[model samples]
Structure formats: C-alpha cells, structure tokens
Target: MGTEARRAGRRDFAGLWASYGLSNLGDGLVVIMLPLTALTLTSSPGLVAGVRWAQTMPYVLCTLAIGVLIDRVERSRLIRWAHLARVVALVLFALALSGEVAPLVALYTVAFLLGTAELVADLGTTSVLPMMVERNRLDGANSRLESTRSSLNEFVGPPLGGFLVAVGTVFATLSTAGLYLVAAGALLLLGRRYDPRPAGESAPAAKPRIRDELTEGLRYLRGHRLLRNLALMVCVMAAAWSGWSAVLVLYAVSPGPMGLSGTTYGILLTALALGGVLGSLVAGPVRRLLGTRNLLAVDVITGVIMLATPVFTAQPWPVGAATFLGGVGSGLWNVTVVTLRQQLIPDELLGRVSSASRLIGWGGMPLGAAVAGVLAQTVGPRPVFALGAVACAALLIPFLRVIREDTIRAAVASRDTRGE
Candidate 1:
C-alpha cells in the first residue's frame, strides 16, 4: 500500500525470480546428465530410460502430499529446503561417480530425490507469487517467469549439460549442486514479511486436519466448473503433446522419415524452446489483443499442426517449424491458465488446487507416452502422430463452448466479491 511496501515487494519478487531461474538451470543440467550418465553404465534401453522414469515418478506419487506441505509450511522455506535437497543429491551423486561402484540403481534413487524436490519447488513458486506481487502484474510476471524457464532450462541447459558431461561427470554434477545451493541462498535473503503463510489462517477454525484440507482442495477444484474444465483442457493437451513427443526421435532421427543427424535433432527441439521464448515475450500483449478465449483456441490449433506436420512431410525443417509453433501455443496457454487460477483460487486453497490441476494434467503424459510407444511399434511413428492430431483437434469446439470469456470474468468477479 505504501511506497516502502511496494519497494519491498519488488525486492522480494526479484529474489524469487532469480532463485527460480537458477534452480531451473540446475534442474536442466540434472535432467540431461542423469540420462546420459545412465547410458554410459547400461546398454539396456529400458534401464537407460528408467533414469527418466525415476525422475518423473514422483509427480504421480508425491504431488498431493507436497501440495499440502506447501500450504502448511512457509513457502520460501519449503522452496529453499527443496533446493537444498537437490544440492545434497547432486553432490552425493558427483562423489559416487568418482568411485568404481556407482551403481545404476543408485542413480535412480538420486533421480527420485531430485524430482521430489523439483515438485516442491515448482508448486511453491506458483503458489507463492500472488502473495509477493500485485494482482494486476500477475500475467506479466508469469509471462516473464515462463520465458526465463524456457530460455534457461529447455534451451540453454541441455546442451550446456552435455558439454559439462563431456568435460567430466564429477565436474558437471558438482556444478549443478552449486547452482542449487546458490538458489537456496537467494530465498534465504528475502525478508520475513514475504514469507507469511496463506491469508485468513489466523483463526483456528480456518486450519483443518491435513487430510480434510487436501480433500477440500480437491473438491474445490472439482466443484468449480470452470477450473475443472481448464484442468481437463490442460490434461488433454499434455497427453497430445506427450504422445507425439514419445515417438518424435523415431520420426526425426537418421533412418527415420526426416533423416536428421543427432545434432540436428537437438536443434529441432531447441526450435520449440525458441518459440516458447517468443511466445512468452508476446503473451501479455497478445492476451490483450485477442483475449483469453481466442488465445486458448490457438493452443489447440497449434497442437494439431505440430502433430500433423511430421505425418505430412519427411523434412526436418517443416517439423521444426511446427514444433516451434506448438511451443508458442504452450507458452501462451501456461501464462493464461496459471494467472487465471491464481486470481480465482482462494489463497489458502491455491497450493492444493494447483497441485490437483497439475496432477490431472501431467497424469496423462506417461499414459500418452506409453500408448504412443505401443502404437508406434504396431502402426509406425507416422500413424501415432496422426492419432495424436485427431485427439488434439477433438478438444477445440468443446473448449470454446465451455470457456467463454464472460465465464472467466464472472469467476474473477466472484472471487473479488467474496474478498478472497
């Protein structure tokens, strides 16, 4: 409300954003190096891919419990703890690599620890923003955060991580650990006022048992028609994207249709990140110009084009262009949907609600990938893309009908009316 408060808020938000970027950079390094490290020690494809399996498994297993913890604990501390956990995990892994007995199974445990920490950090970051900044700036703030994530985590970190591994695994792992430690320190520097728990929690009655609170959060998301629909939209979109992504290497690499070299395949993936960067930069202005409804529809349309492109053409460039567009749509969707949920969800319910939504959304990815693998094996990679395109296209009309702009405006108005 006062000038000093504004300055303090800005200072705290800066800390959060800086920590977020550094943490993402650390995560990106681990994501790449973990898999590549597994490959060095194991020749079995399943065991090699099991590294990714270990990392991602926590989203399915730990999200709700982590969500409850975020709502219960001070957010910054939770985030800082998560970062510290990664630091320990990475450092231990690094030390293990120096020994002759760095077992592949042990790597899976480290991956799990890193993933669980990531889940906490990500949910904490999302739920903490509304407390730190003015509501008017949420869209812009989210856009900037998304851009930073795409730029550092997806585009820059993987290649850099690869280079680090080539230098030495111990060096790369230790360096990633350093990034997480610095990220933890960033949050520790923020003032105490920025670290308060959810509002309206002073009253004893407002605090429920953990199980009850988790259930209430789930019910809140399920009961709200708009939020429920939005979550489903995200779930379906994630499935479609994952479906194509599962088989993309088959469609793109040498001896596949596109005939891309290993280096070119990486570059093609970077094109998607490039689009995410541009999309995040433009999201605020585009939301103002086209409005939410049209922008969301664009997300679905891009999904179709992205999946269908490989089916229609054997050229890497065209598929690269399509994936880039898909990334743009993703950037736009993320800023819009996340900002919407933040504004509309009660602050106390924000953590649980967001985690529930993500659970529904990300729950589809593994399934999509699994199904795509089977389908690709049976009918070939091209047919898998076609099936994914069809699934994505099916969402268009329903999304438009249910997600009218006025419904969202009414939801925001209701939240304000309730003084939530």
Candidate 2:
C-alpha cells in the first residue's frame, strides 16, 4: 500500500486496538490464574513470587533483544507470530493440566515462555501506535490504548482469575488458556499492517551495535530531564506497589484482625478493578486540564491516599476503601507517564527506548516483590507495607524538584513538532 493509502483509513487502527484490548483481557486472566493455581498446589508464598519471576524474567533479560527484533521485523508480522506463540504456550498448559502434571513446574515453564512472547508482542503492539495515528491524534490514541489496558488487564483480570479459582484451580487455568486461544483468534482477524519505520525506508545497514543501541536509548531518556526524573520516581514507587501486590492475597485471606475471606476477597478485588476502570476513563481529560506537572501533583496526593491502606490494617472495609483511592491515583499516574513518554520519545527509538525506560522503571518490580516476600516472611506483611509507603513517599521528594513545567513542555513539544 502507498504511504497515503496506509495513512488514510482509521479502520485498521481501530481494529488493531480492539484486538489488543481483547488480547490484554485474556492476558490479565492468565496473570491472575497462574498465581492462584500455584497457591492451590504448593501453598507457598515464595513459590507464588517465583511464578511472578517466571513471568518477569523475560522482560528483564530479553527486552533489549526484543527491541532489536521489533525494529528489524514487520511489527504486524511480529505481533502475529508472538500471538501464535502465546497460543502454543496456552495449549501446552492445557496439555499439562489434562495429563495431570504438577501444576507448579508446568505452569512455571509456561509462564516463562509466555513472558518471552509477551515481551515481543507488547513491544510490537505499543511501538506501532505512533505510526497508526496522525501526529496531532497521538495523545488521544495513546490515552485510549492506556485506558483499554488498565481497564481490562489491571481492573478486570484479577477478579476474573479469583472467581475462576473459587470454581476450581484446574478449571481456572483451563479457562484462562481458552481465553488465550480466543485472543489468538482475534489477532488472526486483525489486519497485518503497521506504521512504517524511518530506518526501513532505506536499505537496511548492518544492524547497529547492541551496546550502542542500548546506550543510545538510555541517553535519549536521560537527555530529557522529566523522563529521567519520572523514570526514577516510578522505579521507587514500583518497589512499594510490588510489596502491596505480594501481600494482597495473603492479607485478604488472613483470619487475623484485618483479613478477609475467599468470596469477600473477591469483592475487594472487584472494587479495586472498578476503581481502576473509573480512573482510566478520567485520565485523558485530567491530563489535558491539569497538564503533565499538575497531573503528577495530583498523583502525589493519591500516593498519600494509597498510604492510607495501612490505616485499614485491622479491617477489610477500610483496606478496600484505601485500595479504591490508591487505584485511582495509580491509574492516573500510569496514564499520564505513558502518554508523556509516547509524546516525548521518537518513533525510531520507540522499541529500544521504551524497553530501556521500562528497564529502570519496571525492571525492579520482580526484585521488589521478591524482597517484599522475604521481608514479609520475617517482618510481617503490615510492616512491609508501612515501610514501603514511607520509603515511596520519601523517594517522591526528589521528583518534585525534577519535574518542572518547562521540562514537561519541552518533552511534549519534542514529539509534537517531530509529529511522533
């Protein structure tokens, strides 16, 4: 197709987003289901954390390589192959369950492979967005994508997984595997076209040096004052959030002073999910009105609201309420930062740069969760949350100094003028 023709229709972009939205919902279900299945079989917190490692390890280890792959290959073809691999992994899980294999090892292996595919698929999917929309429309388009991901994956995925777990562990994994197959089918239906790359316009040269590519992506992020600060702030916050996630299931199921039971825990999950949905829906408008700086200022307030979760340390209702408000803040933070990143970063470096940025921002999460798990084992869950909250709050002080109006505008304008 001609360049003009490729840019003409919104139909393909709409379909692409729709398919991704559906796929992510399934992805969320898979995320929740794996942990629950492990809990059912092994009943070990570390094992559960280990499952998370299985999922995240690929992102940590393979991200730079995936970025290279995304830039080198056709994004749509890459997505298609990635989804196909996901189907195979899901099928492998089904076979393991059918054959009555040990759920832990089988699921762990599946999670590892699934994470590898997800790394590529996610890079391809997100990197292609800048190409899909007109330059002026990028913010709205990115906002829509973030909203879809937050609402479905973060909000809807957990509760659905828990509900399925309540039904039965094996049944839940099987059901989630089925969802993956459905997502695969959706990807097949979605058209296999993508935005053109600047590098691909000319004859492909020798692939850039890996170290050069990696450092270049980092340099770009560091060059932007806001990006550098935001990335650091998120890394710290991720440590806290990962702690909260590690103990959340345990907290809900505890019989002590502030614990909730099975179905009641599901209710809490549902509330958290609803809060995320509401937060995501409001993100774009909030960013527009507040602009980036004020939006982050609001994020700081929400962080305090999140710290209130400890106030509910003795009751489920208060915990649920705190979680609701925290969800809103987190939702807004994610949408704002993501939109800013898309607006600031160049499309040519979208994959590598995003992967590198994520390395600093998200790379610590699995480690955080692991650390929280060990600490929780010795120190108790409540202390972990309290300490994490205080630490996260302390970390934000530097961020306030880093994120200024000028920095935000410069970051936004960099992409704006470039038509990214």
Candidate 3:
C-alpha cells in the first residue's frame, strides 16, 4: 500500500480507546479471580505462585517475538484475533469452574493462554498509539490510558470481580469472557487495515526474519544509555513487586495474617487503585512542576512503603494505605516513562524497541515469583515483604547514578538533533 493510502481511512482513536477500556476491565476480573480460583484448588504457596507465574511468564518469553510481529503486520487484526482467543480460553475455564472440574492444571492452561493473548493485544495497542497522536501530546494521551488501566483493572474491576466471585466464581469467569468478546467486536467495527508503518517507510516484499528484527530492536535499545538505565530500574522494581505479589492472597485471606474475606480483599485492591486514580489525576501537574527524574523517583519511595508496611504490621488497612501510595508511584512511573519512550523512539521501531525494553523490565518477574513461592512457603509471607522492600531500596544507588535531570534532557535533545 502507498503512504497516502495508509494515511487515509485511519483507525479511530475513540474506538480504540473504548476497546482498550473494555479489554482491561476484563483483565481486572482475570487478575483477581485467577489467583482466588487457584487458592480454592490448592493452598500451597508454591502452587499459587506457580499459577501466577504461568500467566505472566509469557511477557518474559514471548514479548520479544510479539514486538517483531507488531512491527511487521497491521495491529488491529492482531488485537482482534488476540481478544477472540481470550474469549475462547475464558469461556472454557468458566465452564470447567461451573462443572466443578477446574483442577490446578485447568487454571494453568487458561492462564498461560490468557497471558500470551494479553501480551499481543496490549502491545498492539501501545504500538499503534504513536500513529494516532502527536509526540508533544503523548504524555496526556498515555496518562488517560494509564488511568483507564488503573481504574478498570484495579479500582472498579477488583471490587466487582471480588463481589462477582463471592456470588459465584463461574459467573465471574463468564463475565470476563463476555467482556473480551465485546472488546473484540469493538475492534472489528474499526476494520482490519490499520497498518502501523511510519510515514515514508514502505512494506517489505518479503518480511525479515523474526530473529533479525528482534536483534535490531535490542541493539537500538542497548545503545541508548538513558533508556537502558530506566529499563534496568524498572526490572529491579518489577522483580521485587513480583516477589511480594506471588503470595499476597495467602497473606491477606482468612486463616492468614489479615483475616479479610474474599470480597474485602478486592476492596483492599481497590484502595491501591484509589491511589493510582489520584496519582493519574495529578501526574500532569506534577510532571510540569517537578519534571521527569523527580517524577520517576516517587516510585522507589512508594515501593518501600508498600513492601515494608506488611512486615511491621498485620493490619489490612496499613497495607491498603501502603498500596494507595504505591498506586501513586505506578501512575507517576507510567506517565513519565511511556511518554519518554514514545517521544524518543522512531515510529517504525517503537513496537520492537518498546517490547525489547519490556523484555528487560519484566523478564525477571517469573523468576521472582518462583523464588517468592519458596520463601513464602518456608519463612512465611511476612518475610517475603521484608525482602522485597530491601530489594526495592537497593535500586536507588544505581538509579541515582544513571538517571538525572541532565541525562533526561540530553536524551530528548539528542532525539531532536537526529530528528527522530
């Protein structure tokens, strides 16, 4: 297709936004319900974390390949297919739950498929966004998207997911399935030809090998010092968060430390989302007043607050408050870093480079989850939180040394000079 043809009849952002919202709403249900379902099947910390790891490990193993795929094809078709696959997987699992046949294996099977589909769909969304909006407006656009993620997935979804699961786990699972189907339908209405190639880039008559494409992305990201440091910092943070999150349900549920009911546990997740909502609301102003480096710094402090509070107290409210702050940290991190990446990376390479960067950032989460299960099983969940806090704190030294006001400015400046 010609460049003019690609630019004509472009994908609608409003339609895309609506689909994104509905998709994440489904994810919110899955995020809470899956772990809760595993708890019903088995109480072993290792097993529970193992299930969680199953869902997220695709980001580690499959992200790099998905990134290359995004750069090569039209993203709308990719996302539509991903959503449909999720619907099928979710419906099967819901049926298994309703029939009382959902073993641990069933949960793992559904989780792995869901994780893979989610990676493709979510990356497609991020990769196409630069085509829809200008660079100067990326921060605002990303903040809105981040807030949608935080709200539906964390705030509205968790409490609702909890309530639905409390009423009937099968129903909750079915509802999530329904949402994915509807989300897929929304994308279908937008049509299938949302080619994401940047202006002036022609399609290759024959596609390059995935391995070659992936190497190009990795080489670009590796050569960029500022992004390299930022990605590394996120890797550390994600690993620590993974360790604490692996066995969190066991830490808070009945006969556990906090003694909260399943429904109330969802409410606790809501508290964390509450912070994210507030943080998203303020991130624009904070970024304007404080700038990017300082905005990024907030996450480390919030990380300590979140991971340490559980160690010092067995109270649910304290953990809730800590998560609220952590949510703020998350909001700040997403707005600053995503915007930075969008501005800096060229449109053609955005999918591959961003995915490669995420490979670096989230690659350790599965490992952390595996280790966390063992630690929680052996020493108890409380010690896992303490260790997570220590690990989160340890990032400060490298973070301070690498990411600074000058480095942030220099990165953007270099991009402008190159006219990327």
Candidate 4:
C-alpha cells in the first residue's frame, strides 16, 4: 500500500495506539510503585511476591472466559469498559492509601482486580488489531505498539513513577488512575468498524454456553502444532521473566545486594526499556536478515543475558547492560511471535486462540512468582534468578529442534491460500 493509504488505514489504529500508550504509562508507574507499596505493608519476601502473583493470576483464571466474551461482543467496547474499570480500581487503591501504608489484603485485592481488567483489555485490543491493518503489515503494526509501550510505560513511566512515589504515594496512585481514564477516552474515539463479529455468527443469536466456547478455544489450540509449541515456549519464557522479576525490587534496592536507591533503581529499569526501544526499531530489519527460523531463536540470546545478570555480576552497570540486551531479544521475539500468530489464525478464532495460548503461556507467571518468592527466602535472590535463567535456557532446546522455518512458512502459506 502507498504511504497515504497506509496512513489512512492507521486512522483507527492511531486511537488504539494512543489508548494503549496511555494505559501502559499507568502500568509502567504501577510496575515499580505497586511492589514498593507492598513492601511498606510487610517485609516478608513471599508476601511481597504475592503482589506480582496477584497481578498475573487472572490470566489463568479469567482468560478463557474473556476469550469467549471478546468473540461475542464489540472488542472496542470491551476495551473501553476494561480501561474504565481499571480507572475505578486505581482510584479506590489511591483512596485506600490515605495513610502511610495500605493493608496487605487491600493491596492484593486491587492488584487482582486491576489485572482482571488488564487481561480483558489486552485480549480485546490485540484481537482488534488485524482487523484494522493489512495482514502483511502485522509486523510493523506490532512493532509500533511495542515501541510506544516500551517508550512510555517502560522508559518514561518507571522513572516518573519512582519520582512520584518519592514525592507522595497518593499522588502516584491518583495519577495512574487519571491516566487510565484518559486511555478509556482515547479508545472511545475508535471508529465503529473496529469490531468485526466472528465468522458464521450473527449478532442476534442465542448466547452460546461459556463452557462450550471455552472448550472450542482450547481444542483449537491443542490441535494446532505451531501454536501449541509456541504456547509452550511462551509459558517457559513468562516463568523465567516473572521468577526474576518477583524479587527484583529487593535485589536492586536492598542494601545487601545491588544497594541502589529508588531513583537509581528506576534509572536501571529504564535501561531495559531503552533496549526494548532499540529492539523494536531493529526487529523488521533483523527478521528480514535472519529469516523466521533464526529470528525465533533470538530468545536464546535473551536467556544467556538473563543468566548473566545474577551469576556474572553484582555491579549496577553490568546488570544494566545485560538487562538492555535481554530487552532487545524480548522485543524481537514479541514481534516475530505475534506476527506469526496473526498470519496463521483465522480472524473468527483469533480471540479464542490468543486467550487459550496466553492461558498456558502467561499462566506460568503467577506460579513462577510465588515460587521465586519462596526460593528467595530459603536460598537467596541470586540463586532464584540463576534457577529461572537455567529453566529459560533449557526450554529453548525443544523449541530449536521442533520449529523449522520451512514448516512455519508452509503453515502461513496454507492459511493464506484458504483466505484465513
């Protein structure tokens, strides 16, 4: 398509992008603020880890149900509602924090509810994307979204969150709530055409049983070889990332480890986001240069860097460098995997399949976080990080052996021939 046509095509996408960026900014702030707030409530590592677990637990519990809902309703409307729900959750959280500390139960409750909204919003927004852009442009579209997310949520959001926390916890919480409201407003600007009903289904039909719909999604994922394999890989990757991330605040800020202050910790986290930005910029060219098969293997590089983070160095600069490199690999992997899924899955089944896949892939995260917390208490944060890295690296062996470029290409070609 020409530049003008592409730009025109992106008109709806611009709204989606802006909404996601705004929401991600709030997410970015919460990433640091939430855990820090949890720490103030209690010093226990397991309880602190529970905060991360709460944020991810909904993926396992609610994703399948959400998948069914997304396919049946207007996805844009669902997204708007999710963001508005998030706004309420954050506002309540801010209110709960009127004192110097919040109750642990309250923190977990808000975290879980916010995560529930996030899961629905993510599923709806992702499913809506292929409808808005050409199939061939999936890579570019995803790259743009990831880049914006990284820049706003990761890069700008973290440090800003840290600063806000330093200034006042209530201020940070309220600011995050305001951002979610803005995100909801931006999503409302999307055109009516954004939500396309599932194929072979009319608007006025009797509601299908949720269990049957959930089973259909599960069966579709179970039957697809490529998707099944990819989901397994995602599961391992999420586990590894979450395991290390669960205790990362303690490792980074506590006097016994890296011994960094809040401001420095935020700056350090920004290194990872900055690397993600670079990775987004390079993903297209790297895909072209490396071919799909090799491109998929980039996670091995990420795994290595992750392993190096705790085992190889305790110094801040080296840790930051490793994080940056890992972020790059993560960026490439996201673009490749998401584009591949978009190409291969039928639009009618996209929401279901995406949710099912994530149910397996992202489901590992909460378990990993909980486990990492326990392990950190028993062993130490460093060993937990090391173990997580090892698991990540080992998981790659099956992926490298099973997934070939020819098979992936053939699958996409076959889907295209069928007009999926």
TM-score of decoy 4 = 0.96
| Lowest summed lDDT window (length 10), candidate 4 | 192-201
TM-score winner between candidates 1 and 3: 3
Candidate 2 per-residue lDDT, tens place, 130-206, comes to 66666566666766776777677766776776787788766776676666566556655545455436735764578
Best of the candidates, TM-score: 4
Off by over 4 Å in 3: 1-11, 99-102, 189-192
Ranking by TM-score: 4, 3, 1, 2
Task: Let me know the TM-score candidate 1 reaches against the reference structure.
Answer: 0.90
Worst 10 residues of 2 by lDDT: 187-196
Model 4: residues >4 Å from true position, as ranges? 1-8, 99-102, 198-201
lDDT rank, highest first?
A: 3, 4, 1, 2
In candidate 1, what residue range of length 10 has the lowest lDDT sum?
Answer: 192-201
> Residue 355 error for model 4, in Å?
0.3
Model 1 alpha-carbon miss at residue 99, Å: 3.6
- Tell me the TM-score of each prediction against the true structure: 0.90, 0.90, 0.95, 0.96
lDDT of 1 by residue, 184-220 (tens): 9999778855333554547466667888866776898
Candidate 3 clash pair list: none
